[model samples]
Target: MAIRLRVLLALGCALLTAGCASGSEMTFRQDKRLTIVSPGTGKTVRLPVKVSWTMRDFTAVRAGSPVRAGTGYYAIFLDKYPMAPGKSLGSLVTNGDCAGVSGCPDAAYLAQHLNVFVTSGTSYTIDAVPSSGTLGSSSHYLTIILVDGAGRRIGDSSWTTSFTVAGAAS
Candidate 1:
């Protein structure tokens, strides 16, 4: 009877392990690319512009409290300069906790000047209108980047394009 009980326990453990092993393995690649689809470079457009884009290889997943592998989100940097491609964007620090971080701005500052967070999607269309009275007619640079589950930047960092806000002084 004891031998039978031990066999049953061992079988259960093996089944659990086998079940886990059957799931798809995580794969990593360095060839992911992001391309802006609308707002042709240097094109003049009005406010509340529609921005669209496409991505390859990367998977978009809702960001949870705990980040998961191969799943993350995207951020749009409007009119903000971009870091060099492949450079690391360290921890995402907001105004509430900008201590010791150079160039760190608070949440309100970012919200007004930067769209630090956007929803996760393989392809997305965003209605981008600068907050009322926030931006004058001017040429602005837009950049898109992929951030991993851990809030770390992945893929090329300098994927940027530019467009002019119609009527904004060039």
Candidate 2:
């Protein structure tokens, strides 16, 4: 009976491990130019931005570009969560928290047809504030990436910042 129990346990463990490893790990790159500004406190932190990407079962791909998926077939996801440690995540998707880890994801964010409150071409301008009108924490991190059906990485982005929370209205 013990032998049978051990065999069952081993099989269960194997299945779990296989499931976790089924997804291919993506590669990430970073841009050195990063700027984070705080409002009331008037503080700013300068840092770098990193990006991750994954692709799988792509129907087509541009040279040196991410593989492509047919319409309604699949879509690329950018981890809006920082994917970095000590980073906080928000329901608003303004921050990411899966940093420095592989296969461990926080939230899957779609890069298509999503609202990006940014001034620059592709950056989002986050404007979250506290009701007190008092300046508090500053900025949040966001992850951006692309992938194909084959679960291979194409590209991505990452950044962290501090911002002053707004105070209550007068």
Candidate 3:
């Protein structure tokens, strides 16, 4: 009876291992996050403005690398939100957004639709700030989105912050 019980336990352990290997486990990639560390939101700053950030549970790779899960670069948008291709007004999208590390966009397509500054590094410097409207509202929104090396947007990994550009009032 003891031998039979041991055999049953062994079988149970094998089943659990098989379940894990077959992707029956819930993997939480949502914990992967990015945070802007400099130029606090709502703060006024001068140009050539330097923006920096911190990444957790993610890997930043250079452009042109093979599209892979959890590996990508940053696309910095000025006064704009990073939207998936055709979703953007007047966007002549020819490629799709990255979904779960697949269907990544190439650099050219992203540049045409997203209008972003691509970088693998954590920091970037904005040399020029666009002119504010007649209201002289120098406030601007800077957003950062993670994308695969192929330039496709990653899963929900985007952040935005606002700051006034010094001397941006027109």
Q: Please provide TM-scores, in order, for all candidate models, with all chains considered together.
A: 0.56, 0.25, 0.63
Off by over 4 Å in 2: 1-30, 33-120, 127-157, 168-170
lDDT of 3 at 130: 62
Each model's lDDT: 0.59, 0.32, 0.70
Whole-model lDDT, candidate 1? 0.59
Q: Which stretches of candidate 1 lie over 4 Å from their true place?
A: 1-32, 65-69, 82-110, 122-137
- Candidate 3 regions with alpha-carbon error over 4 angstroms: 1-32, 85-115, 133-136
Query: What lDDT tens digits, residue by residue, belong to model 1 across residues 70-104?
Result: 56777667765444444433443334456776545
Estimate, for each residue in 36-122, the C-alpha lDDT of model 3 and write its tens digit: 987789888988878999998778899878888889888888776676732322232434344444433444444445555778899
What is candidate 1's CA lDDT for residue 73?
72
Give candidates' CA RMSD values in order: 15.3, 14.5, 11.2
- The predicted structure with the larger lDDT, 1 or 2, is 1
- Going through the candidates in the order shown, the clash numbers are 3, 38, 0
Candidate 3, position 52, lDDT: 96
Best by TM-score: 3
Model 2, span 1-170: residue lDDT tens: 99999999999999888857433473445544333222212334232222222233323332223334431111222223322322222223333543555532322332322322111123333333322322333343333332233333333333333333223243
